[model samples]
Target: MGAATGSATPRIVIAGGGLAGLSLALALKRALADGIDVTMCDPALKRDPHGDKRSYAIAAAARRMLTALGVWDRVAERAQPILDMVITDSRLQDPVRPTFLTFAGEVDGNEPFAHMVTAGDLTAVLLEACRTAGVDLRPEGVKGFSIQGSRTDVTLTDGAVLPAALLVAADGGRSRLREQAGIGWISWPYRQSGIVATIAHERDHEGRAVEHFLPSGPFAILPLKAVLQADGTLQHRCSIVWTERAENVPTLLESHPEDLLVELERRFGLQLGKLAFETKPQAFPLSFGVARSFVAERLALLGDAAHVIHPIAGQGLNLGLHDAAALAEIITDVMRLGLDPGAADVLDGYERARRTDITAMGVVTDGLNRLFSNDVLPVRLIRDLGLGLVDRMPGLKRFFIREAAGLTRQEAPRLLRGETL
Candidate 1:
């Protein structure tokens, strides 16, 4: 059952060593041990691992998957749990923003619905785990690939070609592998940019996350773990996602540090006391995309390679992690049955398991962005009333919280359910 062929172990090559790729490699190695060979390639792996200055909101189900993969324990102290969340809608110049909806962030008893962790910390731990699990980590990415019957011949950037039972494109939204496979991408620019930065605040946040729906887009203030300063004083911090018109991003990025802080303060309010930049603000163009297919021949797409949605809900990374978990489970199940992991049936099952979930999230985020990112009088009134109504319904609010926690699916992957493959 361990061998794909009589005396041959299945070789799985993954392109892109981001969160999704690394997690998938680690999960496969840990589950199959020496029975499977997993290789991950990404040019970024050769550079400074901490160069990524982004942070992500890991949902409860994703966190459970990490724990099952032995990643959570290594970075548990660096994770900041969201105890509660508040949502409000208001104009930029409004003197006050009224909270229309609030949620207590617990899904299963004491388990937090989500946790915030910086990209550097989470990737560092996953990389270490993959290394310990004996996954072949290549600093070069897949240059291209060709499917030949039951296997894929992956060409690396270094002019090396390796044939494998499966080639997973965990590369991100602009995946070259996906393009080479002729997967049609359905995408549209939102004409907006998401500005991300870490800021120090004088007051504690008490693990509360806030989302203010402005006419431009959603402004998220997510709490981060405290950091000790050079002077030996603990500094409270929060990660902010400021969505603004794409045309305005260049000016905001080029603005003087003081001037930028002023813009931040306009929306940040004074509830957290004085705010100072802990990291330079960076902006990324926002867009919505979904691949026409998640699998082709002997290849499978994961993470941003398969889909990219607006950051309005902060579910982008979690969605990718879900892909990894689902794909890993399916591959494990097929291989344990002594079947080819790259079989048409195997890929079909993977697609069937994920396409609906991905499409639903895309629709949801797109709808939310359109519903909230406007200033029409009637639209605002209707949205506010809806929020208020949902807030008043305890059952509905709990359902949303659980959905955000990624725990609503009855057929969730084993890892998502905190179980090993």
Candidate 2:
């Protein structure tokens, strides 16, 4: 159940089976010395089809991680590359959505800035890769755990006990393991809700993504693969992340289908042609949260467990994927040197590498949500002008694009660089 210090193959128990946990398992399985054991626990993994029917904007860095993990082949066919992006600022009733910024989405001649991938597709592929890599997938949640010298004993919800050289808490924003470890966090509920769903459009999106900043929040139109409708005809489809005031979201969610479409059309515009719901809409309350520390003894937090930011930039998942690669790289490097994977200094290295990036992203997303989610004329004018100025400066625009693509940092993990661990 556990590895002896500095000798036996180390055992790593990850307490979540979402993208973060699975990716971590796969990364470790590929990087660690042979015989190392990786186990992931989450009841949801038992579901035949995982995910809530939403799409994610996968940054270039994340795509590289998927490629290095050898799962991108399965994900690539279904992925929709975002070849361009248009940013605008206007009210819902405005006759025009003025483009204040535009980006040519390719980072290099070969790579696009990002791709739109359904959550289900990505998770299924990652899970299969984890299985192929020999990760022990447990269909039980982690109830809690206790850290002893050189070993951590985990308690599963089914009352089973397991031991590992290191315990990872990837259980998400409301991580029970994190709370049990007494990790403090900073959190604030935004008075907004992100309404998500897929819609069929009359015209092709041609791989362009759009973000319209409104008084309530940002409405993002992300491209998705065409799907066969009930009539057996292939229809163009797109994903929508429509943010509205928190108080107004409930009413919107409860509104009649016809009425909801009217409101949607108000913000969505007719740029992509007529739109109809391809899937029922869902709403998630928006919030900003960051754990005070990313590591605790034999445990480390990943993904939403460590930080949760506004959906304005769609960088949440990418950040967690980065954490998985970084942590895996750090642990495997030390282990290759005959050092303990759970050594305090090894964990400290992971924290030092990720904390700054996480904090910077949190600040950027929070500032964007505040600056653009208001109706004040002066503020709007200033931000719009700033956006326009950035758009005009090719060098500055490219810099921002590279940052969003997750390539600006020089000390990133191997997977982020499209290299194997």
Candidate 3:
């Protein structure tokens, strides 16, 4: 198969409709010529907000990317900007939760370093934008695909075949397509599991996020906006990601609600006042996996499909958004230059642009998780001192804040800089 002739637009098929796939479709629609065709496929109709009771920390660059794609206004309505990030290291029962380090949580012009966004809200906005952009939204999974010279034939779960110049696998970390393509990945299974839930509190979070480094893992309390309760009153709410040893996650998940609340309160601290469950608790196994390569013949990987890293830094979604923006940029450039979208050169460029950042983040998150997820005295002392020192250095603090905010300012996609891709 080759490029379709007779006025048929160049087709690009993106599998998986999560943040990466949806954002890529929107970005491409905005950047590529109107003659280009984009189709996004997922097994489900929509990613329901209530399905996952977790929120994401969207960095400034990723937020700008959303703005460029025209989805942030809707997202901002429910989004909670993180004004500060406080870090502490202590046991769950420690009498004092001393602040070892803090980040101002702002970039230039006082822009928030990140915002806490629910997966549902983000997906809803992106899905609407894709629809408005004339994207072909398919509610079918990609069962399998075969790549031939200059084209890819994709078979849907319903046995429908769709041909496209390029096929992208954004099917998440355990990407079946990636495996089907025989792409090998290095996997490191952490003995930890992340327990995600939403909580109603008696006090406001004041736009601050907290990360408490416990022996088992890092417990992050991300801020969220007040939600209306059934009693006709607004209640303060927050999303909590409690990382515990893999062995203990079962007990934590099986505990009674009241009993679970007690344990939550201990790790969550009284800073937020009394807490109650706003959503059912869920646990997910944590692991680090990065694909050996991000591209194969006529196929490419994005987001969790490319790399799944530790969540210690909460950059998983941010990294995925970056991928979307970058890939869209590369593909748009390829079309503008009259190059095949799925050409080896094009895919190689995309992979080269993304691999370094993804690998760096994997290493950073893995290192940070390892450094803090234990109670070794010497390691603890060294890390605590390092944190304190960084906290004391204003320039270093700003650098870290900007870096964490994804403001590297080098080869970042135009969308990430609030420009058209």
Candidate 4:
């Protein structure tokens, strides 16, 4: 029941209109001249309630990408730059249980490592840009997909079949279109759940972010600017990314708001004031997932569809944004040059350029997760030593800070270099 993309302006079909999908559409529309066509399918975006629960820690490069797409300034008010990040162990019984770590953000130059922005604020700005650029927004989700001799046929939940030069699968993990295209993913559950919530504090955050290492996972406190209540009362706000064991997640969510805040306060220490304003809490199972291949005959997997890493580094969304920016650049350039948008050469080039970065990040994040999540004595000794050495070595620490900010050297795209609109 879908409309076939006629020999129109190199029509690119994107599925899943969350951050990655929408951002890709907006970025492509801006980068491509001559009315490049884009279509995105997402159903849940318009119906999101209590959008306050979702947020992200976007790297400096990701912010630059948004600025190039003309969406950053629109949502800047809701974002808080991370002035500093402090890491330490969660051993109260053994005070020095190898407790040590490094600090990023502000340590380099005047710039913070990244900005923490809520998903709703980001999506609102992206959606507006997509509309202004005349990109087609499909309300129905992708239900199925098929590959013909030279084309890809995408079926939506509405029963419409649409043809595309390239089928982009941005649907989250467990994508139906990826499976329909016969693409398989490699995933391992960490037996962890990410408990996300927003808390109002009595003291100013000073734009500092904190990450605490515990047996469960990292407990991250991300600063956010003051929030305006319905009645116009200003409140200091910060987001908590608390990772807990899967079995314990249910109990934690069921815990009374007061008791949960108390536990968080105790675990978080008194550096910041006590947590007061508690929003509704939600949790999702955590895992490390990567699709073996990023592309097929006419289908390409992106965002969570391609890889999912630990929340410890808060790189999951940043990685997803990177995928969006990279794919958009490659696809738009090839199409503008009058080449086949989904040609084997073009797609292969993209695959080759992205593989190295994706693999390296996946390995680094996985290694960090394994190292920090475990409480083994040897790991404690080695990681603590590693942390201390890295902390003292300014050069090595700067290298990591640069890497974390997505400024590492590579043949990065122009937009990836923090291009401003």
Model 3: CA > 4 A from native: 1-7, 46-50, 229-232
lDDT of model 4 at position 326: 82
Of 3 and 4, which scores higher on lDDT?
3
TM-score of each: 0.98, 0.97, 0.97, 0.93
**Candidate-wise lDDT, in order:** 0.93, 0.90, 0.89, 0.79
Residue pairs in collision within model 4:
1-159, 1-160, 2-160, 2-161
Cα shift from native, residue 236, model 1 (Å): 0.5
Per residue, candidate 2 scores C-alpha lDDT tens digits across 7-84 of: 567889999888888888999998873758898999998896454588999999989988988899999998999999
Full ranking by lDDT: 1, 2, 3, 4
Residue-wise C-alpha lDDT for candidate 3, range 1-421, written one tens digit per residue: 1233334678899999888888999999978748689988896655464465569999999999999888899899899999999999987778998999998878998899999988888888888888888899988999999976667999998899988888999999999999999999999899999999888899999999999999999999999978888998879998898999999988878888789888998898887788898889889999999999999998999999999999899999899989998899988877776667888878898999999999999999999999999999999899999999999999999999999999975879898999986
What tens digits encode model 1's per-residue C-alpha lDDT throughout 1-421?
Answer: 1236446788999999899989999999999999899999988888777877788999999999999998898888999999999999999999999999999999878999999999999999999999999999999978998877667889998999998999999888998889989999999999999999999999999999999999999999999999888999989999999999999999989999999999999999999999999899989999999999999988999999999999989999999999999999998888777888988788999999999999999999999999999999999999999999999999999999999999999999999999999
Where does the lowest 10-residue lDDT sum fall in candidate 3? Answer: 1-10
The clash numbers for all candidates, in the given order, read 0, 0, 0, 4
